[model samples]
Target: MSSSARPARRRLQRAALPISAVMLLSLASAGCGASVGGAPPCLPPEHTVSPSSAKPGDSVTVSAPDAKCDPRYGEDAVISIVFIDAAGVEVLNTTAPMADAGGFNFTAEVPLNSAPGVMAVNAMPHGVDWCDDTGKNNRVSQGELPLERASCVLPTKPLNITK
Candidate 1:
């Protein structure tokens, strides 16, 4: 109300403003430290397969590390297999939900009519925004296998009885 009191009030307000801001910032940083910086709290899950080589009838076994990252970070983990021919054209693309056990085993019957030479297995956590600390939606690490080219398998060949 008085000139002297006005100055004191302004000073107090200024000091309080900064302190409030610092507290808010600290809370925000703690909640989102992982998305902000430093090595990811946890490296993406690791994946592996048994009998790296397999024919159409043979079952393919796959495994991956647990999805330890918080789901709030965005996107779920995806396991996929890419089949490519000698010409480098993708012939088949297969993907399945990652199991809670961090492992997956599914039998993929080779298409009797499919043309194949080599196949590649890949696994990645899709729809995550590792770069955006603000938590905006984005592809943080999609289609990136923890270890790309983890395994290769050949498909079953058709019988040439006529020959």
Candidate 2:
């Protein structure tokens, strides 16, 4: 409580305040780094495609699990459909960005004019190397589904079209 000692006490308190704040900030930022302390490991998103095989003009639905984990890398998973010919040539390729929901569902009409031949349908985590081969790639989860053949003729029954 002496006047001479008061300045020393104030200086010590000020120094301690900055040190304490820095410690707290360091701890807080440490948690923000990739794979935070004791946090659940983030696995890549999983995907599935309903009716893995389909004909031209058929509706194909692709579903993917949410990609937003504790450490979110990005939003909007991209879903794509690639049509290939019998000789293993890519005919048409289409890609669409879908929001990351608990599961993302995408329905697209396979182009009626798409070349008729064996094709592959793949649903994978956007921007990831889902499969080993490019053209043979299937759903990352499904490993590799056999190549699907699109018939030149439409279905026998009258096809019902609905959005």
Candidate 3:
């Protein structure tokens, strides 16, 4: 090759090294569960419903401890308990703010006219600002969290509500 062409080729080769390094670094960091593009490797929270079997119009207490909610939402986080009938229709929906300890104790009353079959009671954290919106609490689900951001729904378990 010509001398000019040889120098140009060497310059291109030198520039490619830094570009490739940056690309590789980005890809490596993306899979470490540090970003909020998807669900993190957080452990699913445990759900407990008092009086697991209850009649219609009964009061039930659904509690979650060691919840992985962001500290920013420690008191403002919205915790919900939803009951769906066997036919997959919502029978009862109850929501309350997180307790001082970053957990939930939602007391819900079953619908009086609810059907008499097994109902699914799910307790989860809704609308939690994973703190990444503006960098205040930008981390998503890590150890015991369910989602990566407030835009996503947290994990839940089924509680059998009997009639």
Candidate 4:
């Protein structure tokens, strides 16, 4: 990459690190520590993304409280991080839990080939009787009152991608 071509990449990297730290610190400094046997309040599937807008290949920070997400796919307790494209297609990414968090967060890259437009991020319930976005079986027959539950739930907010 040329010196000029590299600025965007470098700026994004610099911006991501401190946002991550602040996320962790803010959670810790909340009224009462969460790990001290006082778990954070549950806000089911509530998610927040830093830099609500970005370019392809840019990193966005997604944070969700563990209280709202059971993280159970069958007996495994699985959690998935995914982005919904302009075409409404979901692109799943890997997840890594913070060292000690009262909340859950994920870092994902906007697909490099993504076309510029408005996209959404969703925390698909891995796979259940209602949702099976990945064909992977986890909770094929779960959830009570299935009729009342939507095919999928959102623990996400919109992320706008720029060219």
lDDT of 2 by residue, 21-121 (tens): 33234333211112335565443345555665567778867666665664343475565545443334455567767554324577777666554543444
Which is the leading candidate under TM-score? 3
The numbered model that scores best in lDDT is 3
Worst lDDT run of 10 residues, candidate 3, spans: 26-35
**RMSD in Å for all candidates:** 20.9, 25.2, 16.3, 17.8
Candidate 1 wrong stretches, greater than 4 Å: 1-41, 67-77, 99-106, 113-117, 129-163
lDDT of 4: 0.51
Cα lDDT listed for each candidate: 0.41, 0.44, 0.55, 0.51
Ranked by lDDT from best down, the candidates are: 3, 4, 2, 1
lDDT of 1 by residue, 74-162 (tens): 33444455544333345557776655323444445444433343444434343333224434443344332122211211212111111
Instruction: Provide backbone clash counts, one per model.
Output: 2, 0, 4, 1
Regions of candidate 2 where Cα sits further than 4 Å from its true position: 1-41, 67-73, 100-103, 113-118, 125-163
TM-score (C-alpha, index-matched) for candidate 2: 0.40
Ten-residue stretch with the least lDDT total in model 1: 154-163
By lDDT, is 2 or 4 better?
Answer: 4
